[model samples]
Target: MKKYIKIARPDHWIKNFFIMPGVAIAFLLTEHSLKDINIFKLICAFFATCMIASANYVINEWLDAPFDKFHPTKKNRPVVTENMKFSVVIAEYIALIAVGVILSLLVDKLFLITSLVLLFMGFLYNVKPFRTKDIPYFDVLSESVNNMLRLMMGWFVVTDSSLPPSSILIGYWMAGAFLMATKRFAEYRMIGNPEVAGLYRRSFKLYTEKTLLASALFYSLISTFCLGVFLIKYRIEYLLCMPLVFLLFSYYVAMSFDPDSAVQRPEKLFKEKKLMLLVFVIIIAFMILTSVDLNFLHRLTSNSLVWVRLD
Candidate 1:
């Protein structure tokens, strides 16, 4: 059970929290409501995303084991350490992905499409020839689009009645890219030099601390601009929340300078007490801003959990 769990990399499933913002934002936009039934469906969708993502992680580690053994830290993974058999890993991937597909089908068509896109992109990301992970800027771009797909899945799970604002989706893309670049930056810094980093990730051969830091900063700035646009259109009251986003980005960037920043594995970010508190504050702010004015959004937000009594 433990070996299987290791292959699942359940700890990293935190990355799939990307799915929540979409559902929450979608509910905030036109619906401003979250049905108990919708929450159940959204849980299923979240599970589907996690299963597929974990399958992808297993595949990536399997293929990367050859080089990962050389990494200072990745050497601990089951695949890299050869603690589990290759055939067992393959079986686990199939089972998890199969269940993921079934769950996606339980949602709407758009959800199915998003699941397929994530699966297909996952294949391209770690597989030979089409492996985007080795392509520098394109690597992060491909991964960022997967974040968009996760958002789409969350949106579809609730009200497929309409699409999220373009601004939110664009912001999601930049934020994902920002995270990915920072991860690379952390790995590079942790390894201490390009020559050593390149041994684990081919694209590192083309990167430098300056470029990675610059990219992280640049993408995060774009993320801020896009989110600012979203706030303007959605609920300006949410603008107050923007500073939290900026701070989160900056905090992670600062952490990346450490030899072993939690940024390397996103789940670790929450392990930091202050960062987690800030995230909690952001969630609370969203709840407050959901129906800032009694406009149409307020009407929908009326029955939302924020205002609804459990009784």
Candidate 2:
């Protein structure tokens, strides 16, 4: 059981939280109308996405076992620690993919398409021929595209209308891009050898700390600007929330520079007591303020429920 759990890398499952952005965006754009919320569909879609993402992680670990063995922290992973066998990993991967596809098909055609795209992307990330991580710009492009797809998946699940040109989507995309660049930057910094860095990620050779830092700053600024616009357009007055976002980004970047921090996985950052408390409080406050009345907080909640039916 321990081996299996380790193979699952439940710690990394936090990335599955990407589902929240989609659901949040849908709510922000529509207002929190329970009618259009389709709780059943949303729950299933979330689970399906998690399974598919888990499968990708399993496959990535299996394929990168050789390389991971040399990675300082990754060497402790189940696959490298020999806690889990390769054949077991492969079997679980197949099972996860099968479950993910079946659940997606049960939801709708759109979900099926999303699942297919995710599968293909996951394969490309590790497969020999078109290993996207081996290319320079393609690595970032692929990650960004995947994030866009995840957002679209959430958007389509709720509404049939074309996505509005809201600041929400822009903020999401920019935030995702910022994180992707930071991850690459961390990789480059941790592994001093240029060639080895390139072996792990093609983008490492193409990106310098200065370039990534500049890009991260740019994206963070864009995300903050878009978030403000989203608040204004929705008549949400909780602009104070902006500072929390800034703090989060700043802390994340600072952590990326620490060698000890590099040994920790990205998801673990969320588990920090202070950070988690701050995030939870901010989110709860936003939800309450937006959903309560016509105040800024209420307006924010109202926007999320735009597609919801009162009846």
Could you say which candidate leads in lDDT? 1
lDDT of 1 by residue, 206-289 (tens): 999899999888999888999999886667567778888888888878878877878888877878888788889888977787
Across residues 7-65, which tens digit of lDDT does each residue of candidate 2 receive? 66767766766766676677677755546678787777877887887888788877877
Worst 10 residues of 2 by lDDT: 260-269
Query: By TM-score, how accurate is candidate 2?
Result: 0.78
- Candidate 1: stretches off by over 4 Å: 291-311
Error of 1 at 8 (Å): 1.9
Off by over 4 Å in 2: 1-5, 81-90, 161-166, 192-196, 236-240, 262-264, 288-311
Q: After best superposition, candidate 2 residue 116: deviation in angstroms? A: 2.3
TM-score per model over all chains: 0.89, 0.78
